[model samples]
Target: MNPRTVLVLGASGLIGRFVTDDLRARGFRVVGAARSLAPAQTMSALDIELPILALDTAALKRFLGKHSVDIVVNCLGVLQDGPGSSTGAVHRDFVARLLQAVADSGRAVRLVHISIPGTADADRTAFATTKREAERLIAASGVPYAILRPGFVVAPSAYGGSAMLRALAACPLDLPETEMATPFQPVAVEDISATIAWLAARHIGDASVKAVAWDLMQLEPVTMAGVIKQFRHALGTAGWPLAAIPSFMLDLGAKIGDLASTLGWASPMRSTAIAELRRGVRGDPSAWIAATGIAPKTPAEGIGRHPATIQDKWFARLFLVKALIFASLVAFWIVSGFIALFVSYRAAAGILIAHDFPPAPVDPITIGTSLMDISIGLLIVFRRTAAVGLVAGIVASLGYMVGAAILTPDLWVEPLGALVKTGPAIVLMLVALLMLDNR
Candidate 1:
C-alpha cells in the first residue's frame, strides 16, 4: 500500500509544525492545514512544497475527498480568549463541525488530537471546558480517534507561559511577597510529535487499538517557580528573589486582562489561563511510552537537548524591554502634550506667532498640536492601532523637527536641547516599531 496520507491541522502552531515534520519523516504523505495561507507561508516550519489547505470545515472536507486522507491530526488550540474568537469555538465547535464533515463524507479517517493533560474532563474556564468538550465530541463522532493529552509542552521558541518563565528567569527584579508555586510535568515538543507520528502510522491499519487517549507527559514534574529558575540558568541569568502573590490575585489580574483582550490586547495572563495553571499540568506518561515504544526525556534533559541560541537570549531580554519601550513612548508624547498645554502654552504660541501664523490662531494652533500629540500616544497604547500609531509617530516627529527648525531654531541650542533632542526621540520611536514586529 502507498504511504498513508495524513493531514495536520494548526500546522503553523508550535506543536503542529513539529508534528507535520515528524509525520513526513516517518514515510507519511503530509498535508498541512492552517487558518490562513499567509502565516503558513511565513511562520510554519513545514516544507514550502507541502500542500497547505485552509482549516474551514467545508474546505477541509474537499481537500480530504481529493487527497484520500487516512489520518487527520489536530494540533489546533488557543491559549486565551479574544474578540470574535473563543476556546469554545476554536477548540470544541470547530472539531464538532470537522467530525460532522468527516461522517458525512463516509471516510474511515483516524483522528489523532492534541489536548491538555489535566483537562480530560470539561470545567468552568474556557480552556478546560472546550478542551474536554472537544474530547467528548471526538468520542461521540463515530470517527476512530486517539487523543494525546500533553502537559506543559516546551520548545526552543517560547510563547505563552513559557515566555513568561523565560522572562522571570532573565529578570533582575526582586519581589517582597511569595506566590503559590504550581507543579507541572513539562514535556518536550519533539516527544509529543513523535508520539503523534507513531500513532498516525499504526492506527491507519489497526481497528483494535484506535480509540486510545494517552497522556504524553514528562518523566518528572517540577514546580512553576523552580522551572523558571532552570530556564533562567539555561539562558545564563542568575536567580532573583520573587515575592509570591496569592492565587486569587493572579485570577483577578487575569480577569482584568480578559477585559482588555476584548479590545485586541493579546495577554497570556487571562483568567482562564490562570485557572489552568492552578489546576496544574501533570499526567501519567506510562501509557504513551507503552503505546509508542518511546521513552520520553525528563524536563531537564529536554532543556539540555535544545541548547539556548543567541536569538533565545535576545528574546528573553527583549520581551519585557519591548513593553518598557512602548510605555515610554506613550508617556513621552502624553507628558509632552500635557506640559505644552499647561506649562509651555505661551512659549508654544510664541513659535506660531514668530512663524507668521496669525496671532488669533496661535492659541488654537497650540491646543491642536497638544491634542495631536496626546492622541498619537493613546493610539500607540492599544494593540489594534499600534502599527498605524507608529507610522503616525514617525510622520509627526519628522513634521515637528522640520517646522521647529524653520520656526524655532533657538530652542535647538537651549540648555535642555528641547528641539535638538527630537533626533533621539525619533530614533526611539523607530526602535518601538521594531519591538512591535518581534511579536
Candidate 2:
C-alpha cells in the first residue's frame, strides 16, 4: 500500500468514480465508499483495486478510526433531493456528522468537498442551497478543508445534464432550440479528478488554499447550443438541423415536466432544471489555475478528446428506447384496467363468473382488480414506489395467468393465444423491475 490513504465518499458517482481511478493511478491507496456497495463492486472489472465500503454514519466512523486515512474526499451529492434522499441530510448534515466523527477520532483528515457554481445566485435551488450550507459547515469546523466548486463537469458516460446535452445533439427529430445562447464554462471530469488528486498529495495545507474554495472552470465560455453542436460534430453526425422554438414553449414544457414529476416521472425538463440551465454556469478559473498550476481543458477540447465510441452512440440512441418502454408499460396497465372496468365490463364479469366466482360478487371483484391494475400502473411510474409497483405487477400478472389457466385451460392454446401472452407480460414486469435500480 502507498503511504497515503484516501477515503472517497460517493465513490460510485460520476465524479467520485473517476476520482477513485485517478487517485489509484497516482499511487495512493484509495478506499471507495458509497451508500450501496454493488455499483462499486463493478469497478473491480476495471482492475482498480480499492476497498469498496458501504457508507453510514456508524460505519464511516468505524472505518475512519480503524484506517489511517490521510485525506477524505466527499463527492456525495444529489440533484433532486426529497424524502428518501434529502439534500439537507446528505449534503449539509452529513458533512457535519463526518466532521464531528473525524474530530472525535482526533485525526487531522484533510477534507475535500465537491460543490458546484451558482450557489451564490439569488435564485438558488435546493441543490445549491444545501451545497452552500455544506461549504459553510466545513469552513467553520476548524478542520483543514478545500471546497471545489466546479462548473459543468463533463464525463465520457453521460447522466443528468450531460445526458440531456447528448439527447439534444443526437436527436433525430427536429427540436426547437430554446436558450441556445446560455453560456457555460465546461470542465472535463478527468481534470476535476486530477485536481482532487493533486490536493490529496499536498494534504491541502497550503497557506493560500486552506478553507478556500476554487471554481474549476474552463478557459473559454461556450454557448449551450455550441456545445451540443460541437458534440454532434465530434460524433461525426452534425447534419441534424435545429429549428428555433419559442421561449414560451420551453417554459411551458418545463411547467409540464414539473407537473409530470408530481405524477412520478423523473423529467429533467422540470422548472428548477430549466431555470438552472438558463442561469448558465461561468466562473473565473484564475484562482484554480494559480493554486494548482494546471490549466483545465476547454469545452471543445474536452469533447474532442472523448470521441464518440460505439457504446456511446448506442447509449445515445437507446435513451429514447427506455423512455418508450416505460411509457408503453404504463399505458398497457392503465388501458387494460380501463377496458376491464368500463369498456368490457360485461365480458370481465362473465370471465369472473366462469371462474366459479359468485354472480353477486363478480362485479365488485372486477372493480377491485381494475382499480388495483390502475394503481399498479401509477405506482410503477413513480420513482419512490416503482419497485413496489413492479413487484405487485409481477405477482398480479402471474396470479391472473395461473387463475386463468385453471379456469380456462383452452385459452392457452387458442388461436388468439390470450393466456400465452401473459407470460411475456410477467417477464416484462420483471425486466422493468431490474431497470428501475439506480445503482
lDDT at residue 164 of model 2 (Cα atoms): 72
TM-scores of all candidate predictions against the true structure: 0.87, 0.81
Top candidate on TM-score is 1
Please list the residue runs of candidate 1 whose C-alpha ends up more than 4 Å from where it truly belongs after superposition: 25-27, 37-57, 119-122, 173-180, 238-256, 305-307, 338-347, 354-356, 360-364
lDDT of 2 at 51: 31
Worst 10 residues of 2 by lDDT: 45-54
- Best candidate per lDDT, number? 2
| Deviating ranges (above 4 Å) for candidate 2 | 39-62, 119-123, 172-178, 203-205, 244-249, 252-267, 350-372, 384-439
| Whole-model lDDT per candidate | 0.74, 0.76
